[model samples]
Target: MELLFIERISTEQLEDLHRISVHTFRSNYGHLNTPENLQQHINQHLSKERLKTELEHPEMRFFFAWVDGKVVGYSKLNTGQGQTEDYGEDQLEIERIYVLEEYQGNGYGGALIQHAEQQAKTLGKSNIWLGVWEKNPRAIAFYEHIGFRKIGTHTFQVGQDPQTDWVMRLSL
Candidate 1:
């Protein structure tokens, strides 16, 4: 079945989006991080109020993919917002791109990335960037396969442990 795509989530969809985020995040990262940390991440990132606030942001936008009447994946992009000031006028960043485990490895991720890149181009951004956890080699490889180059790194705390992440980018 073809997935129906939603480019702008409506207010009514906020709760469903939050539910999807929590479910997808837990299933995808639960084994990769401590349960405590994973729980913390979900609490901070997937709350309905937080997501609604994000959607209300003037510079924030997201794309969602649904199949069989259920959302399976989503990707969000936000304008520089200080995160890409180093790269300046030509750059914007992907805030998040997630596909449920069952929907992964099926080209859904690539489609979303391509859509994000096009969105950046439409915004007149010359470059698009995203951050990836160091532990996710598969994700790194996938990004590279799609033309993202690793340019830098940053340290972040996932739950209670400090970890490094790679900054990857592609020219739009």
Candidate 2:
């Protein structure tokens, strides 16, 4: 494993962003969902146009994890009005954090979460939160290992399928 570096994504990297987002998302969730649902979710949330709009949002931030000059993962953070839920002004929401299948267990996911925490602190946030799918025990364990606690639950729609997500939070 080469040194992992995280870069704040710029609008010029829209194509790279879109590529990684779709690939990682499908790789992670495709087998667990119907083909129609998976494709619909990708089209609705990971499309180039949607990614570009998110990249341009003032309260939203995107970061890419790079190793040996290749992007291996990415994370998306939201503050204020950009947050999916109203966790309040002092909190930052990690809307997405994903590492490619081949790159898992190499600490890239933890690095991405650390990056999010630093960003949240920089923005004067006291807490950082995210929604993790209830079925993903690996993710739930990972977040728990990092000191995040399940504070609530919410419905996360992947296409037309409604799924339960554990709302986890960590106080800075």
Candidate 3:
């Protein structure tokens, strides 16, 4: 197996970040949503400008997963005020984690979560959490297999659609 390398992304890599963000997201969720809704969601949330701003945020971090010099996945981690919900100072939120469809079942997702765990521990956070769309059973199962437990539910907006997400947490 090829080694999967994960590295923190910088503001200078905004274009690569934006490209993968939109591609992975649309590939994962586009089939389940209308074109208009998908477009709206991408424009509002994954726009280059928005991503650039986020890349510069002190409390937020983005990481790219690379295999043989090719990017295959990415994750977004948040702490402090950057978190969508205030889970308190001792928790780190994994706002996003997406692996390209071709890379599914290859252990990249687990590696990303492991990287997130290391980051959380480095930040002195006692727990790590995330909101997974209720519709994505595969992802929910993956998180559960990694010892995350469902703690609650939250509404995640994608365009005008209000989607339900299960809040899952793992204590470090």
- TM-scores, each model vs. reference: 0.90, 0.98, 0.98
| lDDT tens per residue, model 2, 1-172 | 5799999999999999999999988888999999999999999999999999999999999999999998999999999999999999999999999999899999999999999999999999999999999999999999999999999999999888999999999999
Pick by TM-score: which candidate is best? 3
lDDT of 3 by residue, 70-103 (tens): 9999999999999999999999999999998898
Winner of 1 and 3 under lDDT: 3
Candidate 2 residue 85 C-alpha distance from true site, Å: 0.7
Structure candidate 3, residue pairs in collision: none
- Model 2 compared with the native: what TM-score? 0.98
Q: lDDT of model 2 at residue 74?
A: 94
lDDT for position 7 in model 3: 95
Question: What ranges in model 2 sit over 4 Å off?
Answer: none
Q: What are the root-mean-square deviations of the candidates from the true structure over C-alphas?
A: 2.0, 0.8, 0.6
Superposition error at 79 for model 2 (Å): 0.4
Estimate the TM-score for candidate 3. 0.98
Q: What number of clashing residue pairs does each candidate have, in the order they appear?
A: 0, 0, 0
Q: Which tens-of-lDDT digit does each residue in 75-132 have in candidate 1?
A: 8887866353356767878868899888787888888887887888888999998888
Tell me the spans in candidate 3 whose CA falls farther than 4 Å from its real position: none
